[model samples]
Target: MAETRSTTAPRVVRREPTLTGELLAEFAGTAILILFGVGVVAQVVAGQNGDDDSIHWAWGLGVTFGVYVAGRTSGAHLNPAVTVALAVFKGFAWRKVLPYSVAQLLGAFVAALIVRWVYADAIATVDPRTTFDSQGIFSTLPGAGVSIGTAFLDQVVGTALLVFLIFAVTELRATPPAANLAPFIIGLIVVAIGFAWGSNAGYAINPARDLGPRLASFLTGYSTAMREPGGQFYFWVPIVAPLIGGVLGGGLYRVLVERHLPDQTDAEQPTGRIPAEDD
Candidate 1:
């Protein structure tokens, strides 16, 4: 037989996405989140019609759609506080933290600009006595008589509840939602927090959510945006408090819930008999 050689092509392996792609998704998702979130606030403030319940649902649905937009690529960590929480407790890469946070902030800032432009006519018509009067549409304002310390505590507690419930709902060992309903459940959590926790200082559980738009307001003629009515510089509270709260909340979940849950694989294994505890 004549000598014959067979040619075989080398296997090609697919590569993962670059950090830039993930950052883009994070930016886009957060921008969409802020667009809807701030749009609702503009409607309520400038339109003078929407109630707090409407605000809650607007933010909830904003988060739901934002997650659906970015969950596959960036895990929809549209909040810097959320990104930090996942990094510290959920094995996310520490190297990507700053980039992710920056992307989120940029997204919020851009979204605020868009919202401001879209509502420019309404804003001009509703042009209140002062720029400070309209500032709440873009950022949180501490309620009358609410001290900075109290506001900070509210953020901490609210964020703790938010992050803890997130850890619980997303835990594989725990009874996580099936049928890809996690995003909707997460949105409901935001709604619940808004209903129960948004009285004192506008339930800003995410740093970037507050800071980025606040900066936009400050630049857009709200000179007092960074300060409270009581002459206190209130801009830092939402940022700092949520970061601390996120760490605390994630740690609490890891300690209380995750550590105590039965391993999923071990629990699912066939044993041919019920455990003594069940008996």
Candidate 2:
């Protein structure tokens, strides 16, 4: 033969996403969430352009989109309470919990910083002193006549409802929603919680959602960010109560619903849905 020529295309090998990739997904997802959430709050409080209902819907939509962004890569444990709940009940890796939580916290912090920068003029005009009133634009605070104990209980109940419904809707054996629909349903759960319990402490059912912005506010001259207007240390309630509520909710779901579901063979198990457990 005078000449032989081959024109085969090269094979492209795809690798699975690593933990680092997952962390990045979580970080980005949470940043998207906080950007919408904190930005909306800033608009309402600082810019005075919206109302309470507006805040609830925006936050819900934020959660929905956040989950959609990171669900495939990281199982989208955007809330540390969710991460902790999965580890406690659903066999998520314990070693990854702290990393995931840190990533989420950092994402919220960065997003809050961006919101602060964007709304700096409005905030400064409304409350030049950066007092507790201005701080509410970034993080949650107790409502009028709400005591610390009541706020803690509100968080516990709100987060319990969140985790309980999350477990219910994600359980493989249960009639779970389609993977595409699960995130929207979860978002509705947050909205419902906000409508029912937000008045107590603005429904800070996720610790990172509160603490990250609180810290950002503190650094940006809100001296009362870490405390209530009355000067009582109130930062711990959102962090601690939601965690307890997550575990309790997951446990309750397991005992009451999941345990009673009919078992499925390995071959019958579904794939490509939003996984109830982390990878």
For model 2, the local distance difference test gives 0.89
- Candidate 1 weakest lDDT stretch, 10 residues: 270-279
Instruction: Report lDDT (Cα) of residue 193, candidate 2.
Output: 90
TM-score between candidate 1 and the true structure = 0.89
Question: Could you list the CA RMSD of all candidates, in the order they appear?
Answer: 6.7, 2.5
Candidate 1 per-residue lDDT, tens place, 38-148, comes to 999999988887988999999999988888887766778898888888888887888888999999999999999888888878887887443766788888878888999
**Global lDDT scores for all candidate models:** 0.84, 0.89
TM-score to true structure, per model:
0.89, 0.93
Clashing pairs in 1: none
RMSD of 1: 6.7
Query: What lDDT does candidate 2 reach at residue 81?
Result: 94
Q: Which stretches of candidate 2 lie over 4 Å from their true place?
A: 1-14, 266-271, 274-276
